[model samples]
Target: MGQTSTSLCCIFICFMLAQTVFQVESANILFFFGVSSYSHRLPAWPLVTGLAEKGHNVTFLSPFKAKNPHPKVVDYAPRKFSEWAESWDEMNMFDMRKKGDMYKQWLILPYFGIAMCEKLYSDEEFINWVKSSTYDLVFIDALFNECGYGMAHIFGAKVIQFDTTTVFPWYSSAFGSPDETNWIPDMAYVFGANEVTFQNRLINALIPVGWDLFRSWIYFPQLEEITRTGLSTTDLPTFQDIEKNVSMIFLNTYYSEEFARALPPNMVSIGGIAYVEKRTPLPKDLAAFLEKGNGFIYVSFGTVADLQKMDASTQQAIIGALQSFPELQFVWKLRNDSLLKEFPNGNVYISNWMPQQDILSHPKIKAFITHSGLIGIQESIYNAVPLISFPIFAEQDYNAERVHRNEYGIRLEITTVNQAELEDAISKVVNDSKYDPDFKFTQYSTNDA
Candidate 1:
């Protein structure tokens, strides 16, 4: 009996030891965020940093290097492709808004994607490093980085797609997810969840199919050519095959905010990865400013919107609206400080950069006037702050529609943002109890740390 008990104890000890070993085991992960914008990189930071913290060695490749990077995370900023970001800076979104032709916008994507691939391929040092290293898994930006699929193939690593935005319309066929355009609106459209008209549905259906054809017939061939040349081998899987075989997709979407849809088993929603719930102490002057005049509302058009480009009428309208709300202070984020002279009101606090997270979490923040970028929308929702969306470009309109449909805020067209409309939106969002902060949505965020 004593010998039998000893053997059982020994077996239990061995089992626990094996479990500990398995828990601590780490793998080499390659995270490639092809986009250089801070908006794209911000969502991926928590994941990369978390991996490094868990003892996994992460190799991060992007044009923008992270600040206060982890010791285990190696960053490589390829200089050649960094210039492509300059075009984004020069992209006049105001023009796109005026033209109202989405096809023109779509045409630019193929060129941008192809150019990015060619630039990355031409970097011999980066190519050599890719050849020399071994990666257990490769995480690629799902937006404009199809070349990363080939890189994963080179290292014989499992591929994971990191979508900074919600799933694209064409991602249905690629990722084996449902399109369900009958109710689910396209990201570019401002149709509400319940406002899916026949015309909206027809356009939504046709848009995804057309986009797929463009990608498959035009974009994929050029991308594959550059990818093959980069890898120095033509004998590799096509983009279609690689995309279909992706091990998993880390989608930046949540059901609490998005329409419910069936997703493939391999797809995971890790939305709100960038949202910080804990409130940080605000600076003294900023804190004092917010406490005055029946609390303040924060206004920001995000990183890309050039407020200086706004026509004089629109600019004056915005200024007039801000002045009209004298009882309530306004904190505006403008990139160009020259506009500061125009906003010379005691109630309006204009700054080039504001601590967005801290501002949202402040007790005195009554509402957020935003460009309706998904990141900003998510941050505002998690903080339980109501919004007044002045959508600029891209999916901002779509996000604003959701805000409007959900009764969390209102959406206004930037092109026609007059003082009357702006004042009405502010008044509705501030005084309406239905638009007040609902803390329940905070539970929807998948941020563990």
Candidate 2:
């Protein structure tokens, strides 16, 4: 990416000065977003909520609503956005998972991204809201929503990209973050290292370069059309030019823990900054159920994956695995409490909702069998629980590798999973001495890594 010309620089300077003046007077922040996913939104609450608590005027311009919203933050309701999200989530939730197998996503994502941008722009209420509002800085959720960048420019606000994931090479390239791929593997698909080998290191170094080219060639053209269309008659530089002026980018994971990548000065990591100091108490029934047995293994595939969608074979396998150890208790988190009846194992219990953090905190909760979602992994690590990563797709697969490579746990393949496999994995984690002392965990922190 090239720097904005001298004239563009002057305009940016003037805008920054105006924003600085307004920010000094009273920091007014606007968040333009849609319901990308609950996981993406969860990591941002701390930053947005904390700003509100500290007296910054924050306006959240979507209906993905927050809990106990602070007085200083005003949430705008988008009815159309809600309707669209409902239809989208329902199909993806129930449909046999297709996205996991689609490696040729490059063909669709550009158009998909642009179409989403157009839909948001077409929402009269959303457009009216955007036109009527002004802010010192606009914090945008930037997965497929780069159109928010153009919106930031339209409002003459400084743009801050808010991402609830590890910083990536593509994002880094926009803000001059060095593509330090030698030690820094791609977060999406890690060519990881306990010690970086010559082959792994070389491929890792080359992948990001190919990734950037692939993205720039394919994704950016569609984005240019979306940006220009959104801007209407405004005479300004391409959205690509506007992109480089982004004030900062906030990522969800720690930079130091990110295996040594050089990020842009403006990129900030506020990972887990949203977790409350106090954990809510586990429900009385749950606590009592757990106490009835000596110890229990916890199983959850996180919110994104529905356990109800699990093949009958896998379900039977899980039931058989749990039934074999009648003396050892097991708890599973599912989307519906009714799923418990299907298991029919005396030792197995299920809940639609669970205070996972608080449950993990209990000394009796020996091992966590997880789908390796980022949030679950973070919590498991934070609470020092050994994990059994059973990844389903995308980042879950990457995160499963991370858990295993970090020696926090072992991973199992869900595709070819069998009763014997489940039995062996549970028995190994529960009885084998490997998980007993929790993987000598502190050995892999930033200071040591």
Candidate 3:
């Protein structure tokens, strides 16, 4: 009996020691993000929240305020851009529509880069705050050209790149993931060829080589001054080292969304991170509007897609389309008050800010009219609602194209949208058994996958 009791005590001590070791080795992650879009913010929120729940310390750096700040978070707001420059509404849609001129949009990358540099260099308060804190891991959104990669060198920490969309060849190359292929599927199925082509294959090969030379010549000098002490210059990690050093890559897309792509072992697809938490309660008015539902449709052009850019005729056409389908309730998230005032009927409910998640989860929401932003698309998938995708800009075109190709929704390009086409698309999504069932089935399959 005495021997058995002594053995049990030894076993308990071993278990306690193991638990202590694990608690000590657990990661302390610092997340850096360019909160340019709400969609970009959503994907990281769950991961940050999850790490915090596991008792890991997380410090998030962003330009905008966090929607739901966690206790473990250390919010770092960078310098804001000028009002005119910050207004995504003012951005030239015609210019954005142009393809293959990445340098023209180079301004976007630098804008966030400068903002991050300012926070790291000029913001004495933030520098003091970070210097006092300690982190073992750094998670940076790939688009944040300034902070994440640079900080890993400065702090001697392991960096993880978090991609909010499809893994672009340029980024894949930067991570030293082999420049073997470039023909990825088109997020939007516009062109005849696969998303990537022989042309992109050449471009993919050149981008890393060019970027390395460019960074070595131009970017590294500036970064060196900022990161290094006056006596010693810091050595930047090679593209291969960055890739090799990363613990994991988190993708916002699921397997169903990204078909026919080779994913690396380090890459994890936790697509619906935004929907991981229970949704917040809807406002009283919005809740009442949904509760009375004879089956309603939710419409929004997403954050970056300027609904204000739509001509008066287009707005009227959308209103006319909604009016045509009187039996179906319409919950339109309109930015313009004039547009809302034009549709003040009992059947139509209009709000400048609709609780998107709550609205999508509502039982009465039969279909979503979206600009096909990744977040909106994911939400629609999560809710198993059919989509009327009107792609406006960026990957939205790709998202809409995929929705149509997948048979989960209909696509109506903004440039060609008319009242009849809009009405027809909504009607088909609502009444067609094929569309909704396929959407739900795809959702279920994706979840299982």
Candidate 4:
């Protein structure tokens, strides 16, 4: 009896030791996700929740809250944040697309970053809250959201960037990630920068330098000024110094969807983190409509393009082409539903929202007609659906150009596509058989770490 009791006590002591070690390994993490869009936040949800599941205390600061949240995660947003964010969302993409400026990508985004800085820094209570909190790691959503670095400096924590798109030249330079300018193109460059022409090569080489100068001379300096004001901490470091101290970068892309780039040990690719949920059953009405036609095609410009406010000429062109193709069913994600009455087509179906994964993965889906956003392209690749892309603005042009180069899809000229051009492009993409999947990124990325 004495021997048995001693053995049981030893087992209990071992269990207690294991539990203590587990608690020690857990951390207090801060996610500084401000007024980023739904698409940007969606992919990060899995990462946030997954960390929480592992017993880490995650504090998420966002302008919006998750519809459902993990038990261990604490959420915060200023009362006025939602209202301010809604106004930015209401900005017209149609007007932005009408203007043709090559420098728009490089210059316009930094201007927006300055605005986001003002919005976040202006809230004195929020600043005080951050100052009081403790953290082991700080996460910043990259792109124009670089202002997040300031929060990291305040907490004296390790910084990691959750990049919405693949890495950019500025990020590559700042973090010392691999940049093979000879084959791998600049993210902003349209149609894949292969360095085929002397002019193109020169442009690619100078693009990074121009943006770096702009950041050094204009953007980062403004950010640093905002971060320093009213802070009682006697020793204040420049934003550039803080930027260099980032410990890791978790991009929303992986080897299957994007080309395998030479990333450093600190750079980890965690693609499709948001796509953890399986595709649920489609609505009966949508299923019935899809079944009624011999074949159907899917169309969307991602979530941001308020199709209701889209340019009238562009709408007319798309409508005209759909009307011409009565033989095939069309599933269009045009939030402006009145168009069904205005230009009625027997074979067309329009909805304000779509379950993209289900529709793309469906056997009935023949091809996709899209504006070629990065997420849209990734969806198409995930389902192996060919693309008919009209890349209008920002990274859309770059994505469309990539589809064109890779031969997985065809591109329609953004500024010049009329009814005939739209029809021709759609038909060509439907019939083309030249897409090479070996070059495409299709695997489900599993790097959650």
Using TM-score as the measure, the top candidate is 1
Q: In candidate 2, what are the lDDT values of residues 1-449, reduced to their tens digit?
A: 24558779889899988876744456879886653655666677667777888788888865466555667778775777766666543433222333344224323444556767777777776776677777889888876567676677777899888876666546656777776766766555554457578887787677667756866776666656665665464564666777888888887665433455666678877665655447777888887888789998998877666766777777777767777877787888877676556545567778877777787778888789997777777666666678888877545656777677667788887655788888888777777786645454442332131
What are the TM-scores, per candidate, against the unseen true structure?
A: 0.90, 0.82, 0.81, 0.87
Higher-scoring candidate on TM-score, 1 or 4: 1
Count of steric clashes across candidates, in order: 0, 0, 2, 3
lDDT of 4 by residue, 187-225 (tens): 777434444687776777778888788888888889888
Say which candidate scores most in lDDT. 1
Ranking by lDDT, best first? Answer: 1, 4, 2, 3
Query: Which stretches of model 1 miss by more than 4 angstroms?
Result: 1-23, 192-195, 437-449
- Clash count, predicted structure 1: 0
**lDDT of each prediction vs. the true structure?**
0.80, 0.69, 0.68, 0.75
Model 1 lDDT, full chain set: 0.80
**Model 1 error, position 131 (Å):** 2.1
Candidate 2: lDDT over CA atoms? 0.69
Candidate 3 Cα RMSD after full superposition onto the native fold (Å): 4.8
Candidate 3: deviation at residue 102, Å? 9.6
Error of 1 at 415 (Å): 0.7
> What is residue 270's positional error in candidate 4, in angstroms?
2.4
Better of 2 and 4 by lDDT: 4
